[model samples]
Structures are given as C-alpha cells and as structure tokens.
Target: MATGLDANGAELFTLELARFNGQVVLRSVLRDANGLAERSAWFAIDPAQTAIEFAWQAAGTDAANGYLRLAVGSAFQVSGDRREPARLSGLRVLQQQGVAWVSLIGTGN
Candidate 1:
C-alpha cells in the first residue's frame, strides 16, 4: 500500500492492492483523513523500480492519453527512452521538485 499527499500536506489518496474478480488488483482513491472524493484508475505498478504509474482515461477506451506519471524514490531513476537513460540531475523538472528529502516506498524491491 502507498499514500499520497496534496500540496497542503494533507492526505490526498491511498494506493493499495486488493482482490477484485479473483485477481489481485491495484487501485487508488481520493479519500484520506479529509473525506472521499473520486477514484483514479490505477494503470501499472513497476515494483522493480519502486514506481506506480497511472492514467486518467475513459472506460472502454484503450488509447494513449493522459499523463505519463510516476512516483518513485532514491533507488529509482527516470529515463527518457528505452535506449537512452535520463539523469535526474539533467532534468529541469527534478531540479524544481527538489530532491532534498525524498521518501520512495512501494511493493517492489
């Protein structure tokens, strides 16, 4: 299981694994200490990289849409492509997000 916090440091959501239709499923909902809001579709979980990637898409639609999002920690590294690996220090976004005290937790190693 994992937890997300908003800009105000409020509990934003919780991501967990559950049994759905006799299969293990991962899901996320916008319900924390505040209250219940909406549920975001859980896409993929990369345990090896300690990352959970998701997308907000319409049902019955299998298209490349929404954000290519990721939440990871120190041991995890973001890349540009399959062949070329990207260095976080080389990216302006990471510099803006700040890597001072990051906590990355997931089911993966």
Candidate 2:
C-alpha cells in the first residue's frame, strides 16, 4: 500500500517501481481521477536541482526513475517508463478543506 499527501489531503498511488529493460515512453491516458497540474513536478533521481524533489521510491538506475522529466500537469499518463519509454500512470489531485491540493503520484503499469 502506497501513501501520499499534498497541501490537499491523503491519497493512494503506485509507489514501488521495479527495474526494467528498454524505454517505455507513454503516449496515452488511462485514468487520471485526480488532476495533478499546477501542483506537482517530476525530477531525476540520484541527483538533480535541489529545488526539484525526487521521491526516494523513484530513485535507482531505472531510467524512468533517473533524470527529472516533466510536471504531471493536468495529464496523468503520458509517456515514461523504466527501461524503455513506457506508459506512466497513477496521477491525481487530493482535495482537502476548501482547496484542491497539489498532486504527487507514481507511474506504474
């Protein structure tokens, strides 16, 4: 079970990612119940701009978890994988109080 929370509320998403082989760039959208735009951002692992925060779960040698990519924005599943560019999923916005908080989800298929 994966856990996540933004300025909004708590939510669940794919956090544990496995090593892959080739590039798995995403080119479609499956489900984005929570819009993640204007909130979160994608970053590289191992290292990147301190300003950009990469989840420890997204660390390692996996390409998908390597370099920082793009903000998940309104689009959830776009194009991103471990080995080869695959499909990136699990992105949404957790609402709380009277504000739509930021989104921080994983990309797992």
Candidate 3:
C-alpha cells in the first residue's frame, strides 16, 4: 500500500495492491477526514507494461471526474475535473526488494 499526499503533506488517497478472484489489481481510494471512502476505483495492473492509466468517479456522479497515469521510474501524470484533481505526483521508492516495495507519492523530484 502507498499513501498519496499533497504538497503540504496531507493525506489525500491510498493506493493498494490486492488479489481478487486470483488476479492482482490496484485499488485507489480517496477518503474523507473521517476515513470514509469518497471515491474509488480499481485498475488491472500488467506486469509486462511499464504504466497503467485509469479513470474514476463518485458513486452518484454522471461521469468520471478523475484520471491518473502511473509509470514505473517516472512521475505520475494526472488530469481531470478541477475540483477532483489528483494533487499528488511522482513516486519515491523508500525500500525495495524484488517484487515487493515500500513507496510514497508526491515526494520525488
């Protein structure tokens, strides 16, 4: 799991990897101050690819208002509605060994 933060170091969202139906997927969750999920989405991660792109919206929303592109060894690229912009970018690999890693978002140059 990885916690994404804003420029001021406030928690904005969490990205986690989990197995569902025997397949690994990435889960992105945006939580409110009380830790309630505000919006969330799941994206399939392909180990053969260097990047993954996804879009999401709130439960009652008419359209997707959030988009994110994450690439290994590169900064995160995000774009979408102004009110729901992903304030975090970049990834810092704090620790890594083989396929496992500990990382932080928005902490890299």
Candidate 4:
C-alpha cells in the first residue's frame, strides 16, 4: 500500500495493488472528511519492462482523464503517456520471500 499526499504534504489518498478476477489491478482510496472513498478498475503491469500502465477518468468528467506509465526500479520513473493529477515524490520497491511491495509518495494536485 502507498499513501499519496497533496502538494503541501497532506495525506490525500492511499493506493494498493490487488488481484481482480484473474488480473492485477490498482486500487485508490481517497481520504476525505467522510472517511475513505475507494475506486478501482483495471491496470496493466509489464514485468518485462518493470512498468505499470493505467488510465482513469477524472471524477464526474468524461473529457478529463489521467494516465500513468510508471517504471519501477531502485527509483521510479514516469514516462510514455504519463499525465497524472499528482506529482510523485518518492518510490521504493522491496522484496520479501516471494512477494514484492511497492511504496509510493506523491503530491496530489
């Protein structure tokens, strides 16, 4: 799980990776006054390239959308069609036993 913060360093959301059906997906939960609001769909992970690709429609809008092409390594890099509402600050990948865990920090815009 990852916690995302706003530009001023306030917690904005938490993100997780999970299995949905037979595919892996990214889940996001916004932290608001009413508590957490969760949103999840589909995303593609390319092990060969150590990258994740996803596109999500902006809330209450059909025209505005956000996309990400995140590369994972000792440090993370955003490339390709990357256009996110948040600014990434830090990322780290860790492995224990056979599971991989990703920690991300970002500034929500």
Candidate 5:
C-alpha cells in the first residue's frame, strides 16, 4: 500500500494493488467520501509537485492501473482525470506503507 499526503502532511489517500481472482485490483481510500471528485469505483492518480491528478472510472478497466507520477507533499483533488492523460498509476515502492510486495506476479506493470 502507498499513502499520499497533502501539503499539511495529512493522510489524503492510499493506493493499493492486490490480486483478486487472477486479476489485479487497484483501490483507493480518500480522506473522506467527499474527497473524491466523482462516484466511480477506481481512480488513476498521477502524482505531481503541487497536486495529484485523478482519473475516476468504473472497475475492471485494464487501462485504469497504469502509471502515476506523484512525489509527496502533493495535494489531493486539485484536478480531475477527465482532461488528464489516461495512464494506469503504479504503487510507488519508496512510498509504500504496511506489507510491501517486492515481487507481484500478475500486476501487468
């Protein structure tokens, strides 16, 4: 699991990658339900210097779990994924908390 924080150092959300029924699932826990920009099941979070770009979408979308570019001290909900590029966000190894999976099998990048 990887935790993304805000400029104030508060826990904004967590990005987790897990294998379920032979498929990889990407989930997010926003600080509050209102933190999310839309009522979607998944998000493609691109971490940037000032904000985290989130692309909200339904579950089971293969392109949903690509790659994110977040660095830290990044605020959440600054931008919506509707206009951002579509890239599946990856879990940052260095920013992970809890049990880190050094080697994940079917997580297609």
Candidate 6:
C-alpha cells in the first residue's frame, strides 16, 4: 500500500503500520490538516520491527496512546499511548527520500 493525499492533507490514505521493519530512518511530524508541524518524532527500524494497530490496547496499563502513532526501535521505543485525538488545528506532512517512507498521524478526537 502507498500514500494518497486528497487536498491540503484533509483526506489522507496510507499504509498504516504500528511497527516498521524497512531499516529506514523514519522522520515524523504531527499537525492538523493545515500542513503545520508543531512537534517531531523519530523512529528507527531494521526489518524486524513489530507492527500493531493504533486502536490496539496492551493487556496492562501500559497501553499505547490512541491519539499518536507509536514507534519501537532496536534499543529505544516510542509509544503513542497518550490519549485519543483531542485537539485539531492543522495537519502535518513528513517525508524522506522524496516520497519513500511510512507514517501514521493522529487526527482528533
């Protein structure tokens, strides 16, 4: 699967992966549907990353955030188990290698 942007990043479609194993340096940023990055995220994978669904919850209280896209590296791990999308002012668009990468951004609650 690939990415498809309708307009101004409003309607978006992409291959959502909870984990990555493509061995690529994934550069991520989050915003609303207005193309603005207020924060940044970084993830590194090797071809064995564990992918999961954003709506997935852990068996314990350490469940991932439902409003953010989580990433787990070989030695470091980033989880999006913050909360459901609660705010919306704009959107973010992150890319590496011109158009080769994977990303999952939260919209809003």
Model 6: per-residue Cα lDDT over 1-109, one tens digit each: 2333334434222223334564444433333345454333444545345542222222224433434343444334333443323323333434666774444544323
Residue-wise C-alpha lDDT for candidate 2, range 1-109, written one tens digit per residue: 1233323442322222222343222221211234432223332222122221223133244454522233223323223332322222334444568564433333332
lDDT of 5 by residue, 9-98 (tens): 554456555565655444555443245532224433332233322333222343333223322244233222232222334434333466
TM-score of 5: 0.34
lDDT of 3 by residue, 1-109 (tens): 5566666565556566677897666666665545576444555565345544333322224444545344433424343342443355433332445543542222332
lDDT of 4: 0.43
Candidate 4 off by > 4 Å: 6-10, 53-100, 103-109
Question: Candidate 4, 10: how far from true, in Å?
Answer: 4.8
The models' CA-based lDDT, in order, is: 0.36, 0.29, 0.48, 0.43, 0.39, 0.37
Task: Count steric clashes of candidate 4.
Answer: 0
Q: Is candidate 1 or candidate 2 better by TM-score?
A: 1
Query: Could you tell me which residue pairs clash in candidate 1?
Result: none
Overlapping backbone residue pairs in candidate 3 total 0
How well is each residue in 15-63 modelled by candidate 4, as lDDT tens digits?
A: 5567767665554555443455545443444434554422222222332
Worst 10 residues of 1 by lDDT: 84-93
Cα distance off (Å), candidate 5, residue 30: 0.7
Count of clashing residue pairs in every prediction? 0, 19, 0, 0, 6, 13
lDDT by residue (9-79, candidate 1, tens digit) is 45444455556555544555544234655465543334555544532221123332322124433322121
TM-score of each: 0.34, 0.20, 0.47, 0.40, 0.34, 0.32
> Model 5 misses residue 92 by how many Å?
8.2
